[model samples]
Target: MSADAVRYLVMPNPYLSDGVLDVRAVQPADIEAIRQWRNAQMDVLRQTAPISPEQQERYFAEHVWPQITSLEPSQVLVALERAGVLIGYGGLVHISWSNRRAEVSFLLTPELEKNTDELIALFSRFLDLMKQLAFEDLGLRRLCTETFEHRTRHVATLEASGFRCEGRLREHVLIDGKPTDSFTHGLLAVEWKNGQ
Candidate 1:
């Protein structure tokens, strides 16, 4: 789709106004900062290890670019302040055209994670935007996400955003030498309310 057409298709960021933050499409320039944030968040992000700069660059070249080149299947986005500081980075991936569903993922910087109250509010707004992108912009019917069982805060965030725990894998993920269960959550299009 053309830029103007996409502009018409996307909605305004619900989180931004009166000095609040905004969520925007991720750009090439944002990669290094995003990499730093992602690596810092590895532990809370589950079964993940810190990535080297080379690996991070390769990931964008091999994984991120292909997705954006064909936006039909997926897109990556970032949430940031007008100052150009990255607050969080994530987006939908693993889209199934036949099933009209996609897997959603996101992470906040370690600093943002420390402010629980603000983090919840910021995440709630971010979730609203993700739903708009899925159901409206992408014509998708359902969205799903997964996290390690011990991530109570994130699991609760998903729940509060109307995602239900639909599946669980027992000892499916190895984290810090311990076998940890993973929970899969889902939210149907019918269950979403725009700007609500």
Candidate 2:
């Protein structure tokens, strides 16, 4: 689809909510919180070092803001909020309009990671919202995500949300000096619709 077409589909409003949770465009104020969450959870993220304030600002300016304003953005990110409080952020990243696919990117506040049940519920809801945007709103064919194998809870959440484990990348990354495997999961638009 053309960039303008995509934008038009979601024009005027892009905020998505499921009564309790709200997923809206990332604003300038969200950068610091996002950076903190990412840095605190570096063990599960691809980032190797903490993001300095300047670096985060530059990234928001050069990368994030443009994605929000650009007609053909490679990513469509959003901040996750509950009752007006920021809880997390994620979105359809690495978008391929030609293929009608995009990789899911999600992260919650590190504090929430301690409660497995709550985490699962929140993640599942987030996935549903993401599917709505990807399939119904943007006409995407598929959505995918990759996570370290150690994140078993997260993997289970993906499974519960109907994403199938497609493959495993053995020793794909290093965490705490040990090589770790990663799993990739995918959900087709047809599958999402049928499940609903």
Among these predictions, the greatest lDDT belongs to 2
TM-score of model 2 vs. true structure: 0.93
- Each model's Cα RMSD: 4.2, 4.2
Best by TM-score: 2
lDDT of 1 by residue, 87-168 (tens): 7777676778789898887877778878888788877767777787788767789999988887787889999989999999
Give candidate 2 misplaced runs (Cα > 4 Å): 1-12
Error of 1 at 78 (Å): 3.4
TM per candidate comes to 0.81, 0.93
